[model samples]
Target: MSDNGHQNVTMITCTAPVNIAVIKYWGKRDEELILPINSSLSVTLHQDQLKTTTTIACSKSFQEDRIWLNGKEEDIRHPRLQSCLREIRRLARKRRNSGSPTSDVTSVSHKVHICSVNNFPTAAGLASSAAGYACLVYTLSQLFGVDGELSVVARQGSGSACRSLYGGFVQWKMGERSNGTDSVAEQVAPESHWPELRVLILVVSAEQKSVGSTSGMHTSVKTSDLLTYRADAVVPSRMEEMIGAIRQRNFAAFGELTMKDSNQFHATCLDTYPPIFYLNNISHKIISLVHRYNQHYGEIRVAYTFDAGPNAVIYTLQEHLPEFLQVVCHFFPPEVNGGEFLKGHPVHSSPLSEELKRAINLEPTAKGIRYIISTKVGPGPCVVEDPDLHLLGADGLPKKNA
Candidate 1:
């Protein structure tokens, strides 16, 4: 809808959360379309902790299409950005041609100004692009009055983005179609399906990763036999099993699969020619701590998974969060005291037993982790009704403070 007082300008704002893939999507079959080599499952973390907010403003008065990310002007000609813009405008045109009454006729012909910002670090394996692209596609769809199967559009922007279109457990199906029509994300379960599930994101580093996901995936697909084997033989069965575990709410099965898949994904990275390194010393230590803690309890109390960066995402049930968090504190001892060490959702913690600490026994890595983000399953993209939340002002441009 057009913002009041600026009759020629229509603005929309939306927010979307980053999703951590439990079953990773590493390689691509179609780079242009962003079709993954295998289906992957991910949990949509709560937006209160980490998310992207995007605003799209369409105005007939605007001279040309433009974009701003995190307050700075960015080239709108980037292939991925163009892909999403072209697809959304095409869908809108089709809707208008089909005589859809809901289509905004004036805005359909207008150029758009896009502004996007993330609360968390970008390009740091935190799924910032996934949330950003998903937010863009979603906000544009709403503004254009085009709907239905938007994950298809989001996928072209980023392979993992398709999964961010839905909340809770999601699966990005690596479709068999050469055209990639069937390769879209489907929600395995809604956020309500798993109430007790909790997530702790160990922010080992906020800096951009050494290797971007696109380049790394491309290199791995070309050089690693392990990647090919993983795509062909491993992922299919693993996808089905992951879906079953999520539906059944089987913590042990889910946690084990998450950890194993993460390890194997890194192994494939190692198998690549010249190799790619995502995990650092702190990441390895976090993995060890998780395994030792699980061993001490003789169960999968917590499981850790790393993306294309050093940050570790740990999954566990609500009941185990207190002791697990306490264990993390004992081991990684933050430099900042009190609430500054933790960000995002507030978590109640308990002190680890002295015996439990002794059994898990590890040297505390002071300041190894920047902070921990506490979150859990949350909803997908949502339109912000409050115009005050819009990143763009009435002038069809990013607000000064944005």
Candidate 2:
């Protein structure tokens, strides 16, 4: 189409893992820059459990840049998405002008098409946006041969998503500047640093969250003055303590701080003018069960935290999984109705067939949970080297016409 040849287009695909904040980043000082009010820490989950795979391709034959999310074409006109694309393109242009060896500069300015898919359900409230934005930036940077820190690119996507660029424990530093240029994420420790830690993600319900994290945080910031106390007083001290505990492998201190921070963050959420409900009855019950189980053991064996939804994320030692699962199963068995435990069981059992009885016996009863994902701290975003995995076709466009 343009002066540059259309035959030689470079395509790159990248997969970025999702992260769950331990310290939590609740408020944003600047919406445009994605600057956080307080520094937060998170653990990047394994890609197999929750992740976003994004493919980016550029070619001179295309007319305009476009994006497709979860197989559905999205309006790329959204300001946040546009800001990310424009920033990445600026960096790419800089790299091209510098004649960097790593730059894959095409003779003509080309259009970029991005296609992203999340392995987990969109309704899961599992931080899909974090992985989506991180993967989008990572893939686009590679496609355009941009030479900049991944954290910088990641920050433009989502504040928490920036931490997804690093593996293991990541800390998002809330810089005290108006520009928000210094607010970036850095790795606190590697995944191998704490190999024995295990995470059990309990999917209580995968329904769409009524209040988005962004809107909730904005409300919390505007209404809750306690958030000020947290950002200025509580979090700073707890962050230092948690870092020390993590470094020394002090499970007791780690559990205490983790639970306290989670509670405080949620408290701030409730302190919002109209109040926000991030957790439901099931979530409270799970927390109570975990606390009771730990009290019964006379020591803290597990720690629980929640995000902006009802899902419960439990942290424990690798050796404690069996006991944890047993306790959870005891409390939450599969649902039963009309004496039919599993689905498709006959309503009337006049003769009571042996197979029906056996099936009923095998079927779990009253478990109000969807599923559980077992994972731990994992590595950061990585590029997919195989062309087969790319979401872009040979024409440098989205494979599904997304």
Best-fitting candidate, scored by TM-score:
1
Best by lDDT: 1
| Model 1 CA deviation exceeding 4 Å by range | 1-6
Candidate 2 residue lDDT tens string, 157-234? 777888888888888888888887788888888889888888888788888998998899999999999998999998
lDDT of 1 by residue, 326-380 (tens): 8888899999995798887788879778898888888999999999998999999
User: What value does the lDDT take at residue 380 in candidate 1?
Assistant: 93
Q: Where's the lowest-lDDT run of ten residues in candidate 1?
A: 1-10
What are the per-model numbers of colliding residue pairs? 0, 7
What is the C-alpha local distance difference test score of each model? 0.91, 0.79
Check candidate 1 and list the clashing pairs.
none
Could you give the C-alpha RMSD of every candidate to the true structure, in order shown? Answer: 1.9, 6.8
